[model samples]
Target chain A: MTPTITAFETSPDRGQGLARDMRVRWSLEEVRQPYEVRLVSFAAMKEPAHLARHPFGQIPTYEEGELVLFESGAIVLHIAQRHAGLLPDDANARARAVAWMFAAVNTIEPPILDLQNAKFQEGDKPWAAERMPLVLDRIRQRAGQLSERLDDADWLDGAFSAGDLMMIGVLRRLRPSGLLDEYPNLAAYVARGEARPAFKRAFDAQLAVFTSRQPAAG
Target chain B: MTPTITAFETSPDRGQGLARDMRVRWSLEEVRQPYEVRLVSFAAMKEPAHLARHPFGQIPTYEEGELVLFESGAIVLHIAQRHAGLLPDDANARARAVAWMFAAVNTIEPPILDLQNAKFQEGDKPWAAERMPLVLDRIRQRAGQLSERLDDADWLDGAFSAGDLMMIGVLRRLRPSGLLDEYPNLAAYVARGEARPAFKRAFDAQLAVFTSRQPAAG
Candidate 1:
């Protein structure tokens, strides 16, 4: 059965592929798993039906029969486990790869998300200007540490796993700030991820959604 | 062989188990695994040796023989995977459990971490007072959704899995502000987590670290 996942009918990022669903799509593409999307409007997402799949009322929520799941990291991990290419064969390597995945979402992404709050969400607040720099600095700190670790390595661990997929998604959130350019290596890392065939498929798919949303200018 | 993890020589949370390492420790206790703690001073955490294991220079890195991993969620997941009780036998249920693990760190923990920044790191900033409500509101939003979904469920899924262990850790961060009290269900949920014998053991272990740090009044 082709698994179905939920995505934002109108993403806040408007097809940048920065939405969490993009991560799920990329994972499915990586695994060569055919899947379908159920687009949920913002209002529909907050309703009880969607909330059952994702208590937080967010996307993307994965469903295959009775098995329903939410959270991109979890969904990606599930795909990686079921499929072969995304996880390592060695138990230790597999464990380390999963660790990096967690690091991407938990450690590195928080500050970047804070930047989101400081920028778009709270941009008009009286404190926005003063608070944003501090938030960006925090993000930079995380990026700098990550850049240092990446140093010359292509992937975070031995191989390109779900860890890299999640990391790329998290770091891409910083593109709007242009702060990603400050770390050339990190920027290149994100570029490498986007260049992946699977990532390209996911990106183009999301962009198509945005293109459809745009009304004819004539 | 028992896995060894790192902790703080002196925690910024003053031994409240609010530090990242506490999560790892709690998970270890939950799975009934015996582990060793290798404490590192804040200064040492920035050194190359520590950074090699954990690129971000943070606490609670896991090392079991040749297998070394960072990120508390990763470490906890590793422990859960190796143990019998923390995961489910069914493939789909296991996937759902892992999703909760990601939700705990990615979705639920971000705003709660922001509260830490507002209260501890950025408390002196001019806008700290004004900005706190917005941060709290974000956390409340997540908490509200989580409470609604958790309405009378013994745990997130059928059995108590690593997901609950991670979620309780995230929710415990809100105890200081008493924001969790606003959600009776979540409050009871956290209490239920705390009441676990393993959780009590983990809490006492972490509290001991705090009590040991008490200043000499003389």
Candidate 2:
């Protein structure tokens, strides 16, 4: 069965593929699986029906037959587990890859999210200016540790499994903050992830959603 | 062979079981697995050897034979997958359970971590007092949503899968904040988890570590 995943009717990221839905879409594309997207407005996302699908009332929920799953990491993992491409055949390597997936969101993404909260959520607050550096420093610290770990590796682990998919997805959010550019190899790593044919397809799919919603430019 | 996991020689939480190691330990206890602990001090955690095992240089790295894993969520999930007791036998149900695990860490814990950053990390900052409400409000929003979803349900989904283990573990962090108390059902939910025999064993084991390190109180 072709799974159906939800996305924003108009993503807050303006379809730059920074939204979490892109992770699910990218995973499906990587596994060469065709799926359907259900676009939801911000208002509709909070409604009871959507909330039942996702307790957090967020988008990018996966539904296949009786199964419904949320959280991009889980959804991607689900895809990876069921399909052959996104995980390794070796058991230990697979577990290590999953560890990187958790690291991307739990360890690395939290500080980056704080940067967003500081800029957009608390931008008007008096402390925002002074606190901005602290937030950036936190991101840099994680990024530095990550860069040191990445070194010259093409991917986080031996292969480009779901771990790289999720890590690159999380790091891509730092593009606007310019923190990613500070690490040359990390920047190259993100560039390499984007260059994947699966990633380009997923990127264009989400980008089309944004482009279609816009009025003619000329 | 017994797997070995790392913990803090002296956890910052001071034996409250708030450290991520508790999650792995609890999961092990639930599965009736015998494991060994290797504690690392703050200085040693950042050393090259520890960093080689865990790139982020944090406690609770799991080493079983040839496999080495970091991130408590991944470690617990690894334990869950290998043992029958932690994950539901049904495939779809297992996937849903994993979704809750991600929700607990990614969606719920980030705000809680932000509160920590605001208080302890920036507690001395000029705007610390004023900025706390915003931090608390973000946590409240997620907690409220979670409470509504949980309602009177004993667990996040069904049965006591790894999902509940992780969600309960994450919610336990809110104890000091008094945030968990605001949601009576959620508090009860956490209490139910703590009352489990497995949870007690894990809690006591970690608590023993703290007490052993302390000089006799006068």
lDDT of 2 by residue, B1-218 (tens): 89999999986888899999999999999999999999999999999999999999898999999999999999999999998988888999999999999999999999999998888899999999999999999999999999999999998878999999999999999999999999999999999999999999999999999999999989
Best-fitting candidate, scored by lDDT: 2
* Candidate 2 i-RMS: 0.5
TM-score of 2: 0.99
Q: Largest DockQ belongs to which candidate?
A: 2
Off by over 4 Å in 2: none
Interface RMSD of each: 0.7, 0.5
Instruction: Report the lDDT tens digits of candidate 1 across residue range A5-27.
Output: 99889868878989999999999
Model 2 clash pairs are none
Interface Cα RMSD of candidate 1: 0.7
Candidate 1 achieves a global lDDT of 0.89
Model 1 C-alpha lDDT per residue in residues B78-180, reported as the tens digit of each score: 8888888888899888998899999999999999989998998899999888888899999989998898889998899989998998999889888889899
Over A1-218, each residue of candidate 2 has an lDDT whose tens digit, in order, gives 99999999986987788999999999999999999999999999999999999999998899999999999999999999999999999999999999999999999999999998998899999998998999999999899999999999999999899999999999999999888999999999999999999999999999999999999999
lDDT at residue B32 of model 2 (Cα atoms): 95
